[model samples]
Target: MYRVLIVDDEPMILKGLTVFLQQSGVSIASIRSASNGEGALAAIREELPDFVFTDIRMPVMDGLALCAQIAEMDQKVQTVVISGYDDFTYAQTCISYGVKEYLLKPISKPDLQDTLRKLIQRAEAAKPASAYLSVAKMDEWMAEIEQAIYYMNQEQVTQLLHTWEQEIATYHMQDEQRIEMLQEFHVLLMKKLKARDVNIELRPLLELKQGMSFHTVYQQFTGSIQDTLDSLYRRRKGKLKDPIEEVKIYIEQNLGSEVSLEEAADLLGLHPNYFSVMFKQMTGETFVQYRTKRRMEYAKRMLGEERYRITDISYAVGYADHSNFTKTFKKYEGISPSEYRQKMGI
Candidate 1:
């Protein structure tokens, strides 16, 4: 369906054309009427009708001038000039404005139908092939790409990209759609990588200069993704140090002080969630559990010294209150600090 504009100075002709267009077996979104070329220009700017039918001998701006202005505004607008005169000069002038349809005043049904058919075909051809493709269906590829990149598996990433190309080829997508899909895929990759690291530098798939084939553009796109994966892999591998060792040393040095996982991660220049996950995976314990076990071990060693009171040992081991320390010690050792002291004969 398409919007159409009917321009004619006569009221009866405008109404007649509007009614005839409705019954012409041509489906249209609307039939807008304008008494002159000036009114038609205003209507065109308001909603840019897909087709315009104008009379050649209209007042306040004629049909030839209207077609010229319409072509200047948007050449894609299909113009059909309805002329009262069958003069060759008028026909040539309309042709100069790229108006292909020039119908005599008493229009026939077959000519109008042929004009509508040609306009519809032109509109369909102008649309991008990607407009008909569902991009959300590629979510599976995005998920696999994210996981493969997270694990720094370049070979897996390469293989997955190959599979994606094969799938697109199997679907027999047009070159324009293939290009559009690559652009969309780049956007998805950027979002996933930015979530992992904000400072990650990313660029578009290709410069897309003139005359580049779909094959060349696609090759550049795949190469760019693989290069990005390699770059990310190197950055992560450089930080492959076991961070647990550093965290343990810090815990031993400041066992008497309060600390949060967020602060610790910040000190190591890592996101809290990321650091927390990596910490647990490497040490087999949460930060609090590891700290508690180490603190209890030190507290037991302090019990060997008779001079330092249990309350003093509590404060030394990061417990500001003795009762809280006693509770935690009981939970970890299955007995109170005093019972542990007595059992050890301290």
Candidate 2:
């Protein structure tokens, strides 16, 4: 919704306009009454309304003069002139100050509505394409340019970049100083990309100067840089997916009471059956075999401690039954757990 401010000398006119506007489609954020141009100017500065409707004649400053001052204050404000006079010359003069609509006094409902509608449409059209730089309005266009490079929409990047380059060409920006700063920024970004081993090459600085708006061009450059970073991240992640290695790490960390294939599969977010097949394919051993190997490795470590019994060691590595642990260990190592400990001199 566009924010509108009604400025007029007469209290009745202000109230009538406010009430009429409130009933209309427009959302009136503020209704300000100014007996003269000074009050209106202050209100305009404070609220920074999207649309300003002012009577042409007022003390201190007339609507035409006030419009000029507002134009200087912010070029984007939409001004509409309301006058009792049928003077075409004054209306033409108002036009020079970029006044959108000229409405006669004792404003009719339909006429005011039509005038507001056209004013709104024109205000929207005159607005800068993107709200990002246009609304906040950076002092140095290059600052906006740099920010746009990182966070703007993907499609607008190219067009904005082109516009910025053209602006740089025509603008009397101190070539040596701006160029130096631009180089430093570009090199810094290049270094960051290089440190991450991102393989894509950024466009050359000299090649970026075809755009009219500096901010637009820089936004495009930054957008491309972000895209490259995203692509690199995806590629890096693709090389690190080792399901069997990941499962081994998880199982090693959590092999205790009640450790099960379902638990192991869930840790890696894989179905138990699929995990079982993949584990064997990658490691040349079933999950059951891998678990047994891990349990034996732990058993050896426990044996070295010489403080825990065979039954204790069995349950320590997730085995519930002592007899099952002894049977599995003997089958794999050709000896009982106790005998193996003694033979190994642990």
Candidate 3:
């Protein structure tokens, strides 16, 4: 569902409009009111709604200033202005600030529905490509780019080209600025690729015509780089660590709780079989083995204190049953909790 925010001085208008929009099939994710521009700015900073509707003549901050602030935070947000009259000059200013549409004070239900439908349709269509550009892929891609900058590998150039192709196919970008950006990226890649001990390859330089602007050329190929990179990262969601490291950390932190291999794998977003194999490959020990080893270490420390009962120590380090803890401890440490405490001279 698309999240939309409304900012206006009129309380009745806010509530009536919110009710109308909600009943029209749009989930009014949040309906916030701001008597002035400062309040709207605070709300926008706090929530960052997908779509924002506000009046042009709010006190303290006004719609124009709010548009500027939102633009700084996220240029993609769709801003719609609400005004009492057809003020062309004011509309021009809002348009310059990237406002999508302006609605009169008495907003018709049909107009709101049409505008909302267009926004939802656009978002739904973009969701699939967005999913593919997941956070993991973006981090990997950024690493590859940094690697290319460091090692100047032709492979990085090849990989970058592949990324551009994927993003271009997904996003409908048809702007001259985008074209110029792509051209600049190509030139940069080519320059970096051919760097031989701080000297450029004369052949590539000669290929550039005398009339061609290097900056414009470079921009043409790199224009889509930012959008593509963004999509790639958003799809992956977050940085990924070694699956074994994740499991080890979780086990150590939750030592007093029962943990299964399947649960560990699920937390790491991996299948149980794959995570089991991968964990062993990376750590050279099964999940249970490492968990047991750590628990044994904690048990030994607790036993040294001698103030707590054996059963207390058993549950302290994640064992639910005292008998199971004693059995495992004896099997791994060659003594029961009681004997271990005695040896520690408690």
Candidate 4:
């Protein structure tokens, strides 16, 4: 079943299209109507519709702009332009925006049905290929990419990106699929950095431009990741006694043992109270909170590997009591360790 959104300035046209499509025998899951492009955009952001039928002229945010925005958001959304004017310029604009169908005002029911049938067929044909990697394989690929980034292995990272690009080309993926894959990769990169407790500005990396070439996008994104990692590395080199950095390394290396605030403070050769205040000031987290977060992250990574029993994982991450480990894992992750492993398809 598919969700469809219809947009027009005319209430009657919107109502008519909504009713017609709902009853058009097209397996519609839901039908929504919007009187203008602005409202349609809001609805799309809330829940992207599989199909959009929109008029060209509206008071605010014309159909051409709306279609362009939709293309940027998701290229797979099937769009049909219903316009009263039969202007060549409007048709050309819609064509550039990838509108699949254009119908004149007072569209015939049969014509609409034909267009929808063709769209449905195209959508079914465009489903992810059977040979696409399974979830577990994808997760492993992402982990390898993250490891490459962690070690500042630019050669490996570039080779991996090239391999991915070749794979996308081999599959002849559409622009929509390419964008989706890139976005997923970007998300995994950010999550890996976060799990490592690296703080870096990501606004430029996140703001994807419409119609950017895949090569250019990948270069910029990978460059940003490398730059951020280099910056963090340099900072560490210049500040070997950096308390936050020390604590992060210590926590990761000692996740299987009890790492207390006083112990960490003593390692830094500072009074416990002073170290506590300094740790909070430097990392914006208390010692216990930071250690727990790192342990949880380590536990999650182990869970993704699928070899360890829950009880063994609990002991591995420093919890002596199985129930206590489960409780803390649930508190940190909002799910038990076993549930997390299941969700990861382990």
Candidate 5:
């Protein structure tokens, strides 16, 4: 049984196509509809369908764009373009986006049936790969993937995914466990990136297991994570190292002065908002938190020296007001500066 989505702006057309498909003498497990390309693509991302019957020139997103984005999103589904125009250019363009068939608007019953016949036939002929590895090996591979992603080890991640791409074909697990393993891969990626404090928005790549080939799922799953990791790697290699690293250096050089997020952002050519978010993500701390801690560490070093008075030490560390410094330092160290000094026996 195959799943299908019918995309059209006209309610009548949607209903008519649904009726025609049901009567086409094809084995369909489910039939769904969407008024526009945007909704259709969203549906596809959430749950991939085996076939898409889309009318051209719909509002919000056109049929051409729907097919184009589907290609970019890296999911394979046989698409039949249904349009009133009969424009050779439109048909040619949709074909370029990998549309499997082009049907006229008042879709002929025989044409629809033939399209279904061919699609199902092609799908059945392309045998999906099965994993023969023991469940323990599968678990170990996923664990290695998790560790590599957690540490942002790109080389290790690439090598692991490369192996997975080949090994994914041999999985012979039952349907339920197969689906669960894919879902676990998705979750593991989320957890590992979260551990690095890098926020990534991802659609679970392996949504429906029944229709997608094992290699298809593996490629999409690995491709998405690699894309995200590559993006992060690019940012780290941008201009001159990550922005937060440059900002940390500036903070270190001017430990006795105010550190401005706006100034740091200007230096890095990033908006303050973007810089702030990036800083928090890369360092796992707010600027104020890190600066205060850095200043206190410097102040503590000066306090341990007999040559520097506590008040002068505070001034040297960028605190002009001695009382204010004591307040902030006590908050950080849970003790007054004098007490800390006495404890240090300086």
Candidate 6:
């Protein structure tokens, strides 16, 4: 005979849940409803309910804020968050507030019934709740993990993970709780990798194995994160030493010559078409555009120096025709070479 309160902004949801629970054959001593968290808090002040089923997004106050208030006002009253969002951060926040359950929206009858049954059984047994990590502590750990990943500090990450496992052992966390925490940590790791443009598929790494020890699972998780960072580092290092980069250097050194795509590709032992596509993808510009831009930049610097005549500067930048060089320079710089030199007071 547990008193229950359902809080949601939707009138349909509030009415539907109330009716469904009332007829579910569960021993709900009394059921109440509120349009939002504010109303729910007001109702609780009037008469504290044994359980609260709340929607995460509601007017005036959200379910997370309500859960925090409940934790402070009455730790005995259990809460179950119902939300459409499947975000791991939300689950982590709710768990920190001692939320008994988190049910996704479009809630099924069986899930609701099962959640209710578990809460009722706990209420009947009168078992004391176990201590869990505080929200602030969990946040601190997450920030440390993020910082480790940002700097690719594998040693720091491994140490932090080992410390986390020890914490779980100290707390005597249940199997379900351990898995949930790991899953949330996996989400954070994947998010960090994605921010750095590491596009590896994470599903395989995130899957929890059956009958594996928590320490083993955590080691594997740490390995996966390390593997991703290693792969990204290797790829970046390889790019610096690759033939494509050599081709770029060659282009810069021969800016005064007729640098052709075919010649550059041949130097790298690649087909011209393939090299063209790869260069565009990597540098975000065509080979001709890059060469032309570089040549124009060099021309401007030489013009400012006034060491050579305009005709000599034009030939020095791979332009054999003075009229053609002036036309191209005006196209890119909005002025002829002589006009640019005059403007620069050369």
Cα lDDT of model 5 by residue, 1-346, tens digit: 5689999999999998897776444446789899999999888977789899998989999999999988786665888889999799997898799887898978766677677767776666554535333433554675687656534688899898888756654557754555456666576556544533434434457456466665566677777777776665665563325447778889988888987887887776656655676687678898888888889998888888888999888888788998999999999999999999999997
lDDT of 6 by residue, 1-346 (tens): 4689999999888887886675444445689989888999999998889889999999899899999999998557989999999999999999999997999988866688788767776665564445554433554676687657545677898898788777777775777777767766676556544533334324435466677677777777777767766775675563324556778899889988999998998776556755786688778899999999999999988898877898999889999999999999999999888889889887
TM-score each candidate.
0.46, 0.36, 0.37, 0.37, 0.38, 0.37
Ranking by lDDT: 1, 6, 4, 5, 2, 3
Clashes per model (N, Cα, C within 3 A): 0, 18, 28, 0, 7, 0
lDDT of the candidates, in the order given: 0.78, 0.67, 0.65, 0.76, 0.75, 0.78
Model 1: CA > 4 A from native: 1-144, 209-215, 233-256, 267-316
TM-score of 5: 0.38
- What digit string (tens of lDDT, one per residue) describes model 3 on residues 1-346? 3567788888887887786565453434566667767887777778767778888777677878887777777545788888887889988988888787888878877677677766665555556754323323333454466344333344565667566556644645444433444444344444332331122221222243445654444443443343333433444354423446667889889889889998987786555655675577678788788888999998888788858888898888988888999999999988887887778787
The window of 10 residues in a row where model 4 has the poorest summed lDDT is 195-204
RMSD of each: 22.7, 23.3, 17.4, 19.1, 19.0, 16.4
Which regions of candidate 3 deviate over 4 angstroms? 129-346
Tens digit of per-residue lDDT, candidate 4, span 22-113? 54534456898887889999998888888899999998888999999998885578999999998989999999988979999898676887
lDDT of 2: 0.67
